[model samples]
Target: MKKLDLTKQEKEIVEHALDHWQASNLLDVDKVEELKQSIEEKGFEWKTLARYAFWVALVSLIFSVLSLFADDAMVRFVEKFYETPNIVFCLFFAGVAVGFYVLGFRNKEKYPEKTFSNETLMLAGSFATAACIGFLGQVLDRTTSHYTLLFLLSIAIYAVLSVKLHSKLIWVFTLVALGIWFATETAYHSNWGFKFWGMNYPLRFTLFGILLTTFAVWGQKRIHVLQPFQSTSYVVGLLYTMIALWCLSIFGNYSSFDAWTQVRQYHILYWGILAIALSLGLALYGMRTKDNVSRDIGFVFFILNLYTRFVEYLWDNINRTIFFLLLAVSFWFVGRWAEKVWSKGQSSER
Candidate 1:
């Protein structure tokens, strides 16, 4: 078999994972050693370089498209193009989207090793699809900011494509489209004041995240096909929930920044406490369930909540020297704790 070339961190992770599997009797020692020997750790990260290069190539392609319209004659033609019917642009982009999706599918079958190129095509297709949707919306000539409807259309299109392709990248876009629809629909109902039922952006997304995560965890068994997306959904959902919780800890559910400043910062102590407790609970739950997504998010945010509070309550009253000293000591303690945990894991594996 061809040896796998991996970065140092990737190699460590693979080794640790193999060790865990062996410990659990999922793999014999011989297989574990064979797997380890098959993988080589590289000092240079060519995969990272290739990823960035592909992104640059995609961007260059986009710019090439734009540059077609950069010349004065082409600019005049584009102006005239805009004067044409919205359906024309819609149909044009629809064709482009179809072409890209077809090519992406073809590459998956014909050149499966070209992971980045295949994804780039699908990503471009998604962009074209969005253009098609936007133009289709404009073709209707509505007066209201019915943008939510457009995002809903995106959610549907991306969701269908995601399932059709069984592509995690497309599924991520679908999730993003859903989030856009949620936020836009909420703003639409709230007259664009950026609030819903007195809930600010962070508060609304926190609930949205919770719902997404809960459904992912609970519905994985119900929908076997969606099982492939479970980890991504969980991570994205927890990312939303934890980031929103961080904001809530600082802002205390106030719709306006001015209102938040009207009261003492310490007055929102409960919010901070709530955020910390939830993070801790999630971390513990993750450990119990062997869910790394929950564990990482929870532990990260638990530390975040502590640091944020440290700055919030102490920055003003404490001397600068003392604050820096305390911060340094806290970080050192965290580092030591992490080191201890890592050594413990390593020792147990050995």
Candidate 2:
């Protein structure tokens, strides 16, 4: 059996448990000795130290660039590089992205256990890809705000790479690109107006999120390659939907902030009701269905709604001490509930 490297305290707990098991006749002496030999007491966590070292290296690299400019000769050299054409930058970043992707793939094959490093490399590649796309867009045109086309290109590139590599990080970037595309497309279509089809930005994003979530739920089984990412897509979609709903509760369908402020709080009571009701409903449904993501997000939504309402209606009328006391007590209850839920989950796993 592969040995485990555990801290001194962890090793002690394991040994104690093994001893208890032997006393209870659940494990024989030989089994207890075997279990004890299967673990080593570790004094230091080198993995964590390695990660910290990499972080310091990144910071040092940034400082090195800043320090380079402090030298007169180096500043001239950097200025000459800055004057390079956009197409050259596009090609350079494209090559850098390819290098990172190649290195990431090599690490995945050679040291599959180095999951964090592999993902970091892939993330770097994704960023380089974005930079490449931006520069390519600039190379295509010097004066045009049709950057939505750039986002479209980004979405396509990231989506293709994500599918090819089965990388969730790249998939997340694809979703981000999609969101940007949606925003820019709508804004451009509306001539950068506050109201698009008489619906505000929050309302439009809410609709987009609803569509995305519906598609995720509907296509999970049909799209084999995307099956693993279904939950991610669903949760992200629901997050977008829920955040937009929260904003709708606060701002309503008003075209401008000034107009919303001019209206009474009670005028948008229905929107708040809808948000809270959906949050509570989703929370209860998730608990019944054993969907942890939905349950946690729903609870957060419910808590945020409650706190926001209290701030809006009762902040001025209630005593400061009583208000804070109520918040503390409510949070305590929530913590206890969360503890019980986690305890139950652990017990089930054991």
TM-score of each: 0.85, 0.80
Number of the top TM-score candidate:
1
lDDT of 1 by residue, 1-350 (tens): 99998888889989989988999999999999999999998978776788999999988998998898888888887787667888999999999999999999999989888888899889999999999999998987467786887898899899889888877889999899899899989998998985789999989999999999898889865887788888889888888888998898889888788888899878989989999999999988987897787888899999999999999989999999999999999999999988997798678666
In the range 96-134, model 2's lDDT, one tens digit per residue, is 999999898889889988877887888889989999998
lDDT values, one for every candidate: 0.89, 0.87
**Model 2 local distance difference test score:** 0.87
**Top candidate (lDDT):** 1
In model 2, pairs of residues that clash are none
